[model samples]
Target chain A: MLCLIAWVVFGILGLFSVKYRVLAKESFDCVFRRITFKKCNSNLDERIKSKLTGNLMKFSPKMARGVYRHYEFLSWIFVALFVVSLVLGAQGAYNLAMYDNCAGPNADPDQCIFTPDYDVVDCDDPLCDDGHCEECGDDCDCEECS
Target chain B: MMNVEKIRKDFPIFEKKKFIYFDNACMPLRPKVVIDKINEYYTEYPACAGRSYHDFGTRLTDEVANARDLVKKFIGAKKAKEIIFTKNATESINLVANSFKFNSVLTSDREHNSNLLPWQKFDHDVVKSKKDFSFDLESFSDKVKNFDIVSMVHTSNLEGYSLPVKEIIKIAHEQGAKVLLDGAQSVPHKEINVRKLDVDFLAFSGHKMLGPNGVGVLYGKEELLDGMKPFILGGETVSDSTYDSYKLEELPHKFEAGLQNYPGILGLGSAAKYLMKIGRNNIEKHENMLKSKIDIEGVEKIGHVGESGIFNFNIPGKGAHEVAMMLSASKNIMIRSGAHCMHSWFNSRNLEGSARASFYLYNTLEEIDTFVEELEKIKKL
Candidate 1:
């Protein structure tokens, strides 16, 4: 597990040193601004009497600064959100994997985090307390047997 | 008094949608102060903190130091050096979990994965978390003496039922067990007085408390922090080094191993300052007011609006993942569904699962009404 973390950390460190900037794809011409082309993965439209949408942007030679920036801002926002969500996902999963123990002396061997599948309480205990294992009787107690 | 509309204007997200972003229980949205703070760091003072001697480095160091001081005042930590910035609440817990040595750590199921897993991973025995999803007093009384440390979540990430930290800390003190509170879910929704709580350690993430992500806090009691091991080591964390042996830097410096996220740290300080300026009491009152308005049309939709945030709940019978996909497909409204990272706590119970819609101070009552109203359509699925 430590090996995996070290590998990931190494990978991230390598990424930081690499000097590169990536950009998104865009239409080849200004006329294409009114349209975004999506290749339909489907063979037929299922019913083809459809006129394609030319979702045109109104020509605003003079628009409010904030309004004009909002579209550009949104495009960047989408990019930022996408990247951040990706980064945060990695950080979260890493934290979970790194902190992979709840198997101490105070822990019920049954409730150890690594064993995410384990039933918290014995099914046959007297109380059979649904959530709280402490409320259970000695039914799941294999400690003495061990 | 903090005006909702005034605060709302600073967060452009409110202008974008129905805007009932109540899941501050998970992460708080960033404000202009935090956003500007981060932008300033990147644009003006982009430098590695504590790792260089140049002017840019010194400027970064001063900003981070000032941010740390702000953290000290925010949490009422005895000293600024006790504050260690981490990625999130989970990372903070992992840092605290791995840093300290104790025979065993006592924790409850009420804790988020951040608090539970790290302590759990220390190869320590985890006592059964209390019933009713609240801290069991008897459990603490019976168990603290048997363990070397105690960890707790200040509140349940799900229900927002608060634990008595002051009382829990007192009990742990009596038993010589160190207490650490997972303050991530609780802090942004409410103010924290770490000194008054008297917990040996407290872990919190900034995103959940009106700050940016990639920044969190570990506030340790001065003496315990002095004794605990550092989270990561290298670079600025070291005072002097040789191939054979190296000396560690002092307090917080020794703990922050690499080029820590200076921008996030600054954002975190600003977030705390913003929350403080607004006052904790008002924030709590505002959130609870929204939460109190959660309504049900019938038994069917009740399953849809399970409990908290618009996107932070699991729909029963329907696979959480499927509902999440559907919600995103039909509407641009974003949400998280399914067993959050605390799947173990949920798996422990016989109950199936629920949908959540956690509330925050910035959310308007009108938004809540709109969400509850729109959620009525969700049951149709």
Candidate 2:
């Protein structure tokens, strides 16, 4: 607690220092601030963009042809990852939302809904094993002998 | 042009399924006349080609030789003796490659494997292709002097690229070299003047040009064929035989050494007649017109290798095998996928290879519309 208080006091004193005041003035001033940030924006990576373009330009027609190809490659990777994540997240959320009600006696508001007859999906083709789908073993494996 | 609807009737596949078969690079489904010829040979007088004493066999032999004459005329050869029969274009090429005495050979990666592989793995000194998959006339000419044979495909199977055959032939002759062309893709779709091209040899398949399977043609300069020894030796190829020594048959027969499929020969002969009647110039225009519109954008990552009516494109996420299964099941459209027995070339290009849709003469515009629609649907998936 004391260390936190001390640190806050030191920060306050630093803010009031001569060098600090000039810095604040410089940042708040619109024109100078604009010049500094636009030239050195941390969020927008101008260097990486330039580097990418340079590499892209150096490529001969053949090399330029190759790869994911042009900017479409980057887009494809992004799209693939985005699609995979969205699907996985949706599946996870759905599983969580239905977990308890999936086998609960009071199916209302349960995480998962249970069928009394357990005949919803037929898994009898080896995957279901002897016509059972809902009755799982001690290891939580499904048995399809119904 | 030429009342395509009326022409399409001659090819029975259009009657069965209204499809535009742009995949002629793969193979052409036989026409009714060719198919009927095959059926007649089988039912009426099915006999081995080239040799016989009986009436049916002699008729069959005469028909087979007549087929050779038809092919020679079709390609504008000096003599029918220049033509050699084989199973297909692939075997015809293999025969030439195996027999041709070469210190070195020059071709390009632009070639289908039939033309390229003959020399790439050949125990010869030098086998060279273009740095990229494009053709270079100057490079080819400069190198021709050093190489013994300059074997190249007349038009690339991938791009439908037509090479400067006449110029290349002249260059090869100047260098005292021989040239062979793979016309398997070009012959069925385009008109070729082999005499004008002056190439030493040409090979093409029957199946790709609206004929039956188990039939192909290899056209060599008469002198060259007479000098070179035959590859396969069996019962029919021999002129006379003794226990110790046997003299081989001359010209086309020397190259063909077995009991031939006379049905297949007559079918191919009819196919040649079909081309002659249709006029190759009109067919080239019609097929190219379809090719010009095919949407190759779906496979832009691999891109269309060439828009020469053999549309080759590779999908990024889909391997050709999986894509082929999906296409077969989801859409009634059929396409040939995988490396096409050219794994080495595909591997060198850092690709698993591509799916191909090759087009031919009988294929209609409506079929292309269906193909494009299916391709668009496939892209969405």
Candidate 3:
């Protein structure tokens, strides 16, 4: 389960750096073995677990013990969070493409980064400049007055 | 008493790397002297031995012969011709396996893959170890009569326990069986005299004993070696050859096939000299003292933590590799994990593997404390 997440993370990092490529390949092998219902021969997950636990042991033994004991449960939680984020990201991408708003058509455009800012002024006012009045129509909801 | 601190100075790796190295059973760190000797061969005389008459070649040939003589003295062999250099202990064993005339062969259940794999083609029998993981002499005595040769590991790399080879050899000899002891683990740590042991054949590697890799020694009795055929036939192996008829070289040269590893041989000779200067008995005592200091609770020991330098164990609920990796991560403590190349023994005992911390003369009490302290933290986890 950790290998799946590691593969995605390392696979991306592997494109930029040469160091992570071997680890990326190892994690991919682990994930492939797991999917095929075979044990991971690479022991990449064990290396990661031991390294993490060992680093944690230096600062807090109790916390390290807890993490070591509940590693499987924590892996499941991490996998769940990763899957949820991936789904949410896909949904946001789809919304931005379909409705031109990552927050959806019913949601506020201010919440979406893709939403362009609009400059508007009331043309009914007497103080309205000529440049502003020309761009502003009867309803006056213009993006650029000039 | 061995001056371990002073001894540590001889190995150059300590100056560069800051780590507690406890993987000596697999390969001991080479001293500067051994390294220099290897470098000397390349810088001074980088030529084929025995074939050339130039100054470089003459010097190399002499050096190679000197290395063989040193190995012969190291193992207490009667003649230098008895010493045959091979790639490693595995090749040495395979050489004997291929050349020796034997209908059946017997080995202990805890044989390493090197000792076990070569005999798989022959009619092989295994004498099982006792429940306590000790070599079973009674069972071996019973099985000795049925086999033509009795091959066994002199000291187990798995747990560092030595078999009663003196007794085992006597029993096998009485049954008219030849004995070949794999001394890879034993020869490095303790003093082994082939003549005193009266063993027919002995095989050991150079890298495991502070020597360079790609060189190992096989010591066989002169009479026995004379009877066996050459394991490999090549340029150096033949003294004269016709189109259809060829006369083989004598003794050691007959077995050494191609252009030999001259640098490795010189390094191994230097290693032998270094060990002799330090004294093997002092080394054994130092290792015993170091092993005695290791005391960690709440762990399942693989075998009895005997007087040998190796300490193999498994922290409860943790894999062997996990414990080893944790120790490495915590303090850069190097150790060995897995079956230690004795998979058949582990499989028979229903164990995955063990974490092994093998000490040598360079290892100290402080390193043992660090190892124990890290193991304590791991046990808690």
Instruction: Return whichever of 2 and 3 wins on TM-score.
Output: 3
Error of 3 at B166 (Å): 1.3
Better of 2 and 3 by lDDT: 3
- Residue-level lDDT tens digits of model 1 in A73-138: 544565466668778767545544664434444446465545345344534544444433464334
Top-scoring candidate (DockQ): 3
Q: Write the per-residue lDDT of candidate 1 for residues B36-115, one digit (tens) a residue.
A: 99999999989887767898889988888888888788888888988888787778778777888776787776556667
User: Of the candidates shown, which would achieve the greatest lDDT relative to the real structure?
Assistant: 3
Query: Lowest-scoring 10 consecutive residues by lDDT in candidate 3 chain B?
Result: B303-312
Which candidate, 2 or 3, would have the higher DockQ against the true structure? 3
Model 1, position B221: C-alpha lDDT score: 77
lDDT for each residue of candidate 2 in B268-354, tens digit (9 for 90 to 100): 999998898888888888777777777557574333244466666766665565445434443445677777655656777788777
Clashes of each: 27, 23, 0
> What does candidate 2's lDDT look like per residue over A1-146, in tens digits?
11122233344665869764443343334223343554422211222232233243234323423421344455346546666876776765555456533333354543333322333444443455555433443333345344
DockQ of each: 0.01, 0.01, 0.63
Give the runs in model 3 whose Cα sits over 4 Å from its true position: A14-22, A32-42, A91-146
- Evaluated on CA atoms against the true complex, candidate 1 attains a DockQ of 0.01
Model 3 Cα lDDT, one tens digit per residue, B48-137: 999999999999999999999999888899999999999999999999999999999999998999999999999999998888888899
